[model samples]
Target: MNAPAPLEIIAMAFSLTTLRVDGSPTPALCVDDRYWALADIAPEVLQPEPSRGLMNVFGHWEHSEPLLVAAAERLASAPPLPAPHSLEDVLTPLQYPRKLVLTGANYYDHMRGDAGHSDWDKESKAPLFFLKPPTTTLVGPGRTVRYPEQTAKLDYEIELALVIGRKARHLTLADAMDHVAGYTVAVDLSARDWQRDPRHLVKFDLFGGKVFDDSCPLGPGIVPARYVDHDDLRLRFWLNGELKQDAHTRDMIWSIPEQLVAITEHLTLEPGDIVSTGTPAGVGLATGQWMCPGDLMEAEITGLGRLTVEITK
Candidate 1:
């Protein structure tokens, strides 16, 4: 249970994450630029009540936050142990998101830039959302994303994803932020060639075009809600080390609060439910530039850190 040496520490920030070592998942607190196994730094947080790992921690977040934050703060003065595993041991911060929900076309520039919905207006429109099967779609940072055999068009959309810490429903704009657990970076991988299901005469099918194996890559780790300015942060995406998408969270067509309010009105937002804010103006669909095997993708959101995923056949 020893953590890495104290020489390398992430100054001024800490985030909670789940790591897989020896093929078993365990919760860890990352501070001072190091990942300290929770069992080593603090064992109380891992009580069986909430189950082990980050997934269940969300359900108990309100009560657990103080302990986690305090433990991270004290670790600096306490002895540091060797990191249980190297950075590659990092897994999706949320081992199992209860629901992986995302807002689509929530950015004005993204809509207009592609020339698809240039006239998209916030005052008159509602946010569009979709879901990906959590277990199959979410891969951790540095993991490999499979280029599905079904399509010729593959793309990346960098987005700032919001993690909900509290179970909420019918939330109002005024207090919506209170329910947020924290933030993380998400890469929405896409396949543009999923042609319409001709029998149904549907022009766009979310399932065919968006939902596929390894389509969503989330986390380097989750930065707590109080740790950073969620609305003003920057988002960037790179395809094979070339920056393609660059935008700010402030540019979204509808604010995060608005999206949360609308969605919560219809369904419950439970602990560990990920609500990904939409992507910005740099997807490859408009230019017909498709991704091929052996490509690499890096997605980053300021404060949350960057996650790298390799593309392979």
Candidate 2:
């Protein structure tokens, strides 16, 4: 497996309230694994709207190359993190994404599940996908996930989410990555009771079960595409202190290129749009176990950092 580059270009969004350099919240760039806060670096390109947050940095696709170039030059010196900001201060890196597209049964093992349908074609067909309400499901690391009262079975799905840097419509497989801004780790939280009903066999609300407020937890931060090898990263999930899901990106039935082509075929993907590649096997639904209040869930990807979410009643 080819590994990610040693120099992972990471960045995040912090609560302007929490990033007060001098008793007043300021828009600053947190980079290099949150160790350095490049205060107002390329503010014209990164922080056009001083009041808005990280999405500003991602929305300007035309400026991404230049911004990343400037960021890399600044990162060379390895400046110290500012006194006012802490990792705990980080917010969901990109808030209010225009859309959240997700692939379904994209992994062979995950598709197999317990029922083990052997005839399910793994190839020769386009991927099946679904959409989720964007900001309503989005939260960052260290955020608390309220267990919805509607369902008893809460599940977790760790997926590699792509951040679209440029507008794309009817894109070919070869041109897909050119539209990607970077990548981040995402937990596609689900309430399985809404997904399927084995007893009824007729009613399945996978759409409703898949999306709920605060159901998607993303971050630690976004890693620039240059520093990542998407096809071979290790992904793992932990429940409490025990490891639950472990897999590599290479196992994906449909590659990122293929998935992107499938999505862009119908939807015009825009900057700040997120497309989450599906999760692998080992979700709670397979084991008949569910997360409870006080449970801590951790999802980690090789180059991208770990994302943690706490369960609460």
Candidate 3:
């Protein structure tokens, strides 16, 4: 008998989301508002790659990216695979990242206008970062962000989230892009009132404000980097249909490679770890508006996708 047939390899691009099918994580390819089960569309490709969920796909992105893309290219013309589901049925692209790193005030307008720090000089200063308790902070699109009772000052921030594709440590700014796999829209929800230490034992409590339930609403899906313009993508946010923060990646104080260099200097960044670049100006504290219960938040990064998360008590 013949041993087996080799799988055909080709690279295309599609946004990768996940669905809860029969109690297991199933990959779904998001084509606009519709989502098709990846297993149904490309069983041959899933055979070698992890079909479990989007998180696992990052581990094998080198081979998976192309294979999945080749399969996704036909989505527009292909017949229904059993049938596709609406965006409401799928989960965020990733949930359990090993680390959820966030940049603090990387956007120029955010720093000078919203954060009220005009003296920050990127040329002479290092980048700032904060880590969220991801397991609790992360929620999928269409999910609800529970407004914690601890703080009355809940806020919304829209940022470009980067999905790491390879293990990287001490990489130069020029080589940093090679390790990034994809991009997603992440809302860095915050509790402006709780962001400080009441006890005054420490400088601030970034977690106290940011670690509430559903603090980080990430993804409609992750679009592979090859499919997007990394340097000049637009980042927009909407609160209850009112556009709040509208800016571009060009406004960021530190470049993606700079952010990675800042992070990798402390520890190694592995595949599946998340790095949310930073939010633009127009946070509640800046605009004199705040997120309330029942408010809907939408975050969008150009060429990536939009993520909608409802706020609730």
TM-score of each: 0.91, 0.86, 0.89
Candidate 2 to truth, TM: 0.86
> Model 1 Cα displacement at 309 (Å)?
0.5
The segments of candidate 1 whose C-alpha lies over 4 angstroms from its true place after superposition are 1-12, 78-88, 195-200
For residue 102, give model 1's deviation from the true position in Å: 0.3
lDDT of 2 by residue, 1-313 (tens): 1443343332322111114344543444444344444344455655566455556667775675566567556755665555535434555677568999998788888877733656767656779888888768877666458887888888899999988988899989889989987888999988888887565466776666788888888876776676678999999999998999999999999999999998988989988899999999998878989887888999999867788788878
Best by lDDT: 1
Per-residue CA lDDT of model 3 for 140-244, tens digit only, reads 866457888888888888999999999999989899999999888899888887786576457578878777777888887888777767778888888899999
> After best superposition, candidate 2 residue 281: deviation in angstroms?
0.6
The pairs that clash in candidate 1 are: 3-81, 3-82, 3-83, 4-81, 4-82, 4-83, 9-32, 9-33, 10-32, 10-33
Q: Rate the local accuracy (lDDT) of all candidates.
A: 0.80, 0.74, 0.79
Q: Mind sharing the TM-score for model 1?
A: 0.91
Prediction 1 global C-alpha lDDT: 0.80
lDDT score, candidate 2: 0.74
